[model samples]
Target: MNHRRVGRREVLAGLAGGGVAALAGCLGVGGSDTSPLADHPVAEGLADQPTQGPAVGDATATVVAFEDPSCVRCAAFHRDTVPRLRSELVDPGTVSYVLRPYPVVFEWGEAATRALWATYERDAAAFWGLLDHYFTDQDAFSSGNVLDLTEAWLTAETSVDAAAVREAAAADGFPAPVQRNLDVGEAADVTGTPTVFLFRDGEYRTSASGSVSYEFVTSALEL
Candidate 1:
């Protein structure tokens, strides 16, 4: 993993003056590079995060969901739109889904993603369940205490070895995969959380940012 010198201000953009407004609808903007908007190869490096991979189906198409765990819009999308997408698109073999992390929202964003990565390392099957827990309990505490809360969640709610998760989180290698996702997002010109990219017929087509309706998302998939 190449350690690029990303400024703190850039990472903290979502939490600045306009805050979410800074990120809300900035679709396909230059993200350190140009967007490969046409015939682009499927990101092989982004095949899947080894921790908790995406849900695959017989579908020949794919949708990459770049989201931050502490992002409010993302939680809303998961709560309201994701289920519909699953039943209408994923289950019907219309598209496969990739859940990649883009932890650039609030201050807790990156930390929560690192914690998620660590816990996922402990038990890959608990990925979705852990997401549900975090989204449902988003307001239980602020991002500052995420590690403590995550430790408790791992100990009580899942079969993961909580101590091992803690160890992994504190280790130097914890952020490598998360950084890979960020790199992939930047390469694809993703500039915001909850950005959905549509890939079909061996081409990267359109994308949308923010919490969107299921109909809007499904229509983009051409399902």
Candidate 2:
């Protein structure tokens, strides 16, 4: 909870300046600054999206993950580490997992995030499924045919017409939620993709970022 907010470059600098210990300190190690997660402030018609877990106050622990739909690292993390997190933490009823789309690399991530939420608004269950599709087949959506491809994938998943997703992606104000997420990230001092905040027993324990290994998740939860 230092909340000293470091950008990605600063994260790398910490590693170079003082090795793992510096990075560890930056990640809230041995810190007494216990604070709750901030309520993300979104503009009207841009409320926070539904989280991918049980109701907030009903879990023993919660892992709030911030990621960019277009980030390769986020995709890699989901592919490699999510299964372990599911088996060890979520499936056992040890914690609830919450995924937030934090826009980065605006070229594609912004629109991608918008389409993701729009899909969620239409069909909640299909949201996670499409997230899997987007991550695994990122190249398909990154093309000039992103909207058409996304629509097709979404159409294959649910009854909701994905044409609305395309509309949401192109709207002039589409960046509201993404901007709000960036604000939340700034407040949390998050500077990278796949950043996860671990809250246990109603206390903020720590956070991890990047394509972190399963060990990091397990160890953070252990505390």
Candidate 3:
């Protein structure tokens, strides 16, 4: 329920301080050719686009969220807003929700994102669990131990194959879709975590940066 808003200046400073910007040019271009959402029910009726991420629900309205797994503000949005959003909007099929992994905060953010996609590829339920775990226990991980911790969590808490997930996460390059998510973020001029876009009837609508409320989303959707 707590919201910690991070500004663009602070995000840019973090990127510079962590040397993430330098690594941008070196981002890997090879990995699995399969779409992470290939088997996902939410992929139905969705366009085939490089910028597409995992989706849920079927509706005329769509909500695309770009988030960093290790971002506190993102965590706040997940914790404070997601449950209500699901109950009031997604579960009712009023809107479709998509999650774009934008790892802009921590050094291990990319690793976590890879693991997330791997989990979703393996099992949607486990993927949601891993997403909640990363946000809820962000402090319990670091660059050195993000993969290990994720492996341990998947092994202990989910039915997903931990070893395969680890292998995917430890792959040489970012997964194709994850890399496309980065490209999407760049094109959208995303400045920080939890940047969300709302659309109606497949047309672009408004967007919000940082933590947002259920009311804000509904208002954007004109629901």
Candidate 4:
């Protein structure tokens, strides 16, 4: 990876400031064949980090996305790009898609991430739905309301126990898997939401920061 390695102090400072802003140029663009992928690395040991995030497809080529639930740019990617990625890359088995919650953009992000992991533990399939829900309704959440909002959403849209999810979200500290996600992001030098890393046949290929188009991903994988 060509990413810069920062000391723990730098990482903490970055996190304290909510990291870097999303690349404005990369946001709100639909998938276009003209878009280009950046030459970035997935960082050593990042591929092996434990994650409770949901995934799809079974291809050897994988696209791992590190995102914050409350990030508007990440929401744009989820709303506009993810469906095409699923249809053309993931559903077709050309690439596996994984989402790791980084929760760096907003104060409530960690709570929302905890709720997501709770949903994943109860029903893996429901995890994706809940994630989409959070992204789709980002304006409705806050640090004070994230857990309650998640609880209500889970009750209405899934079979998982809502109270349990709320409890998990309201817990005192980070869950082990969620902490691992933070570690992975820190190790990868992730500075913004919607950072994506690509791997082909278990070998790191490239990465892109901010919203990435399906075309960019396919071009990177040489598809």
Candidate 5:
């Protein structure tokens, strides 16, 4: 993996190229390394967030999706590509989906933590429901309102009364699993949101970023 410094301009522009190539060349890794996905290992110590659908599968492919809730691209990917995969790939028992939170954007980390917390507190279905809420109201939770809105969403979802999330965010202690995600992303050379890794038979086969199409992911999994 390349650790070369990426320019502030490229980082700010959100260039959708840099990391591993999984599908359609859209996946973005964090660093400048050009290594293939087969050479990399999933990052270590990512927080244990509630995840859905590492569904029972015949072929048994596990995908670790690195996402930040505040990223519009992530939302778009879920809205477009994920639904297709859920129906055709995941539901049929061909894939196991593991969602890992990456806190590239500060606000996103807060949202990710709260969202995962809600999922853990509630259930997988409720997690997606709350996620849908966030996606529908993406603009409502900005940096200024990150903690407040995240807490509100969690409260509504889990009906929990604890103020720990808000307090943590205020003290910059929220996004409980941020360091783990950061470590994993750094190790995997993940640079941006929506980066995905497809592991088959315990071997890394491919990776992708951005709004990858269902057809593309389907093809990659075939390898």
Candidate 6:
């Protein structure tokens, strides 16, 4: 139960600029010095968050991913690398992957919330399936059509009772968690979406922002 709960202010701060991270690092908050990321809390019932808790590997290594749905880089990471990670590592239980939604911009925040609700109301498979659709069509939503595109995307995804997902998204049920995620990201000195953290053997390592290759991530894994 030693999980770090991220706050929205931190998330927005990181999205706003890199100054916050510099300050956090100077303050020793983002360093390997006793920060929550360093401690690597055990997240329970994480299925409601984004994806499930890592599949629980024997090597005691865990992957924590922070992503904003509207981020093209995040989409690229999903497309370019995550699938391989899933097949080669996550699915095989070599690593436990925990995803935290770090919704920075408003459009992405709404989508992230909808995705959370989709996972809660539908199922994990449905939620990820919808995520695949989102990444595939990341360019479809201009600022003028965020909600419209999101609604259409939800409607097209299976496993979700689209009506209910949209209802929850409109109502904004996942705001608190999303906000918390933002806060944690900022505190950890994350400058962008797709900021990843790998925890193994009581140590935490950070990844370069955006679509990092599987080789780099795997090489960092302590296993």
Best by TM-score: 1
Where does candidate 5 clash, by residue pair?
A: 2-33, 19-29, 22-207, 27-208, 27-209, 29-191, 30-190, 30-191, 43-184, 57-93
Q: Least accurate stretch of 10 residues (summed lDDT) in model 6?
A: 22-31
Off by over 4 Å in 1: 1-11, 22-42, 50-57, 171-174
- Any runs in candidate 2 off by more than 4 Å, and if so which? 1-33, 36-48, 175-177
Sort every candidate by TM-score, greatest first.
Answer: 1, 4, 2, 3, 6, 5
* Candidate 5: tens digits of C-alpha lDDT, residues 14-46: 445643333224554333343433456563442
| Candidate 1 vs. true structure, TM-score | 0.80
Q: Rate the local accuracy (lDDT) of all candidates.
A: 0.65, 0.66, 0.69, 0.70, 0.60, 0.60
Global CA lDDT computed for model 5: 0.60
Worst 10 residues of 4 by lDDT: 29-38
| Candidate 5, backbone clash total | 10
> Over the stretch 1-223, how does candidate 4's per-residue lDDT look in tens digits?
2212223344357556866343433432222232222233343334443233233223657777887788777898888788888877677667777777777666688788888888888887788888989889999999999988888888998899999989998886666666666766776677667878777665566778666877888777787
Worst 10 residues of 1 by lDDT: 29-38
Error of 2 at 92 (Å): 3.1
Expressed as tens digits, the lDDT of each residue in 17-106 for candidate 3 is 984432232211112222334242223333432122224334757777778888777888889888898887777777777787777777
TM-scores, one per candidate: 0.80, 0.77, 0.76, 0.78, 0.72, 0.72
Measured over all alpha carbons after superposition, the RMSD of each candidate to the real structure, in angstroms, is: 4.1, 5.9, 10.1, 6.6, 5.9, 5.7
What would the per-residue lDDT of candidate 6 be over residues 1-223, giving only the tens digit for each residue? 1123233455456657764543222212122332333344423333346544354334356677877666666787888889888888777766777777766544555654555555555677776776676668877755566556666766665645666666566663355555556555665666556677776654566445555667767777644
The model with the greater TM-score, 3 or 6, is 3
- Scored by lDDT, model 6 comes in at 0.60
Write model 2 residue lDDT over 1-223, tens digit each, in one string.
2222225455456556865443332343323235653332211122255564555546777777878777677788889988887877676677777777776533466677788888888887887888888789886666366777778887876877788888997665455555556666776667667777777765676777665777876776672
Report the poorest 10 consecutive residues by lDDT, candidate 2: 38-47
